[model samples]
Target: MSSHRPPPVPPRQVFTDPVHFLAFGFGSGLSPKAPGTAGTVAAIPLYLLLSGLPLWGYLLATLVVIVAGIWLCGESSRRLGVHDHPGIVWDEFAGFLVTMIAAPAGWIWVLVGFVLFRIFDVLKPWPIGWVDRRVGGGTGIVVDDLLAGVYALVVLQLLAWWWQVLMATA
Candidate 1:
């Protein structure tokens, strides 16, 4: 058995590096424990602001984030000389945005989306796990999470529909 462990990706220099600043989810990814979870939690307020926008506007903004995330996340990983460091969580921000598209109207569902997104992200089932391993650079880093977001989005929509049905019945 080869005990080959890649060296740890160092913490971000949030103040010194702009790429790090964004990739770290404005510092939420810098948390010593569960940085990914921290980044997901930090996304809530941003999601709130974005949710107020018209659906098109929200989707447009999310599109911009995803497109730009490819570069931002890639460069940050390169600068750190690491591939998809746990601390580089711009993907999480972008992923959470993806999960929120057409989400139900309420903080409750937002929380639900967060949990679902996290589950998909952490679990990396199916193509998510495949992409995470097969892809490289920023595309790999962000795409995996983006896929997870898509999965979460589907589950969230289903939940919304179920909720609507329940409310209608009541």
Candidate 2:
């Protein structure tokens, strides 16, 4: 039998045209290096825009983003024949949303959350790293960032609480 290899797939599109710009996180994934970092950076404006919403509204929106991200990331990966390509970054958007949920409503908190989430995401400590390696497809792409978001949330919450306690005691 003659060896037959599949033709090379084209480079993935960044935004699927203009209509899907927001869905693709504003082409942040197209960054030349550290695309995940770029994706997370792209989320800052969105976080600022949504941070003004009422607490319940913010939480609801975050939930929607997370649920939708799985499908979007998966679909793009399917088209590209790659698993978790850097250019597919709906996960970063969802993770940023999760990080902002219940955070103190201020620029300082926002910056802190952003830094913390990026750190944990890049570091991928413990089960986060494990999940990143073992899981496949869209679920794998998103789950690690989701866990990083959780870690950031927990740490920030504890820090906020401790700050409050310290201030009250002082």
Candidate 3:
């Protein structure tokens, strides 16, 4: 057998490695408590940064992240020997992006989207919860959040439309 030894696992840095990077929303997931909340909270600045881009640009970035997130999350989970740990939250970022599509481009809508997305994400209603339970690996990690984003998007759009109708009727 060869004499070479495997490299040592590095000590956890504040914001290095896929697990930490993704778990914290690139650092937001590092909060002492409620990492998911922190991850969602961390998404705001990114949202602000991306939301300013043209819709196409935002859409492209979201797609890239979602694709990359599958690998990152999967690799991290395999290394850690865990499934969908709380800190792996690139999924949340993708979900938030989904929630914003065709959404009102304003802080109010963003806040509403954030809250709604979190609720749907945590509750995992119907198909969202179903996918989370049935799927495995990194694909499972990201799919539930994607569905949550879709749910949030639909609900927010309907609410906006209803508000508009009410305003017109008034």
Predicted structure with the largest TM-score when compared to the true one:
1
Q: 1 or 3, which is superior by TM-score?
A: 1
lDDT of 3 by residue, 65-139 (tens): 789878877876677666776666778888888888878878789889999999999999999988999999889
How big is the positional error of residue 132 in model 1, measured in Å on the Cα after superposition? 0.4
Q: Specify the highest-lDDT model's number.
A: 1
Task: Rate residue 145 of model 3 by lDDT.
Answer: 92
C-alpha TM-scores of all predictions: 0.93, 0.85, 0.86
Task: Give the local distance difference test score of model 1.
Answer: 0.89
**Alpha carbon lDDT of residue 12, candidate 2?**
50
Give Cα distance to truth, residue 37, candidate 2, Å.
Answer: 1.3
Residue ranges of candidate 1 with Cα displaced over 4 Å:
1-12
The whole-model C-alpha lDDT of candidate 2 against the native structure comes to 0.80
Q: Report the lDDT of model 1 for residue 66.
A: 88
- Model 1 TM-score relative to the real fold: 0.93
The order by descending TM-score is 1, 3, 2
lDDT of each residue in 1-170, candidate 1, tens digit only: 99654454455367578888888888887787888999988888888988999999999989888888899999988988878888888899899999999997888998899999999999999999999999998899999999999999999999899989999999
User: How well does model 3 score by local distance difference test?
Assistant: 0.80
Colliding residue pairs in candidate 3: 23-87, 24-29
